[model samples]
Target: GAGVSQSPRYKVAKRGQDVALRCDPISGHVSLFWYQQALGQGPEFLTYFQNEAQLDKSGLPSDRFFAERPEGSVSTLKIQRTQQEDSAVYLCASSVLRVNTEAFFGQGTRLTVV
Candidate 1:
């Protein structure tokens, strides 16, 4: 029963560079979601997937952000043309059952655009 984990818990990038962050969800979970939380703000849903099917992605801030869950398991979130405004904590969560269950969150991938 591996918990969700995100790498490079902290990242510093230039204003125009691209970056990719990784997320490892729990074993055998069916639903996965990504969120972005700005400083002192709530986590906003970025996207969601059930297995390999991406169910929702309405919260992605711009076209520069892309995410995928290729094998119905591990996922990656990529941001192109990083911006100072894009700095935030990217969070990943997963659940075993679909019914309003609490989503366990990693410490988060904190991105800082300089």
Candidate 2:
């Protein structure tokens, strides 16, 4: 059962609510990514980390979104000032190699901001 795991499988957030989603990746995986998916759309890359270093975060929608992998194993994504447009599925994935390598994905956390 060692794989990418995300908590709060479903969340209902009131407007402006602050929420933190968690991801526990498989051991020794180096590439970790966060993605957002809205209805009728494909997953959009949010950010990524290689080991404990964040290599890209340009996909983050706004300053209210943040992600970190301090020790290179577990990662957390924080979203503040939630808005209706923020409602979507947050997915966490990990791979043992680079970005183009095969990756394992979590079941995903569905967030609904109302």
Candidate 3:
């Protein structure tokens, strides 16, 4: 796809289930980010990856949440032992530069844990 693409646009998981969300960023984009958007709130930064290196992950809520961009093109966010509070719209964005550049966002995967 020309823009960022996220798979399984919607997901429903039982409490304690594990889920993996995928993100495919635009070709050659160097900066990739993961954000978690709870209802009625703006997306909050979860992590940032420049190329294959994860430069920042301080925003991640807990160790149960994991994100990686192994080859730097495709990324994944995994939530383990899903809890109700973990439900949100997981957004993926990519930009050409590490800073001062507009990011292109995907439609996001909406996760609902019950």
What's the number of clashes in each of the models?
Answer: 0, 0, 0
Cα lDDT tens digits, model 1, 1-114, are: 467999989999999999999989998899999999999999999999899999899999999999999999899999999999999999999897556797877779999999
Winner on TM-score between 1 and 3 is 3
| Model 3 pairs in collision | none
For model 2, the stretches where C-alpha displacement exceeds 4 angstroms are: none
- Compose the digit string of candidate 3's lDDT tens values, residues 1-114: 688999889999999999999999999999999999999999999999999999999999999999988998999999999999998999999999978889999999999999
lDDT of each candidate versus the true structure: 0.92, 0.95, 0.95
lDDT computed for candidate 3 = 0.95
Candidate ranking under lDDT, highest first, comes to 3, 2, 1
Question: Which residues of candidate 3, in runs, are more than 4 Å off?
Answer: none
How big is the positional error of residue 95 in model 1, measured in Å on the Cα after superposition?
Answer: 0.6
The total of clashing pairs for model 1 equals 0
The TM-score, computed over Cα atoms with residue i paired to residue i, of candidate 2 is 0.97
State in Å the error of residue 10, model 2.
Answer: 0.5
Query: Against the true structure, candidate 2 has what lDDT?
Result: 0.95
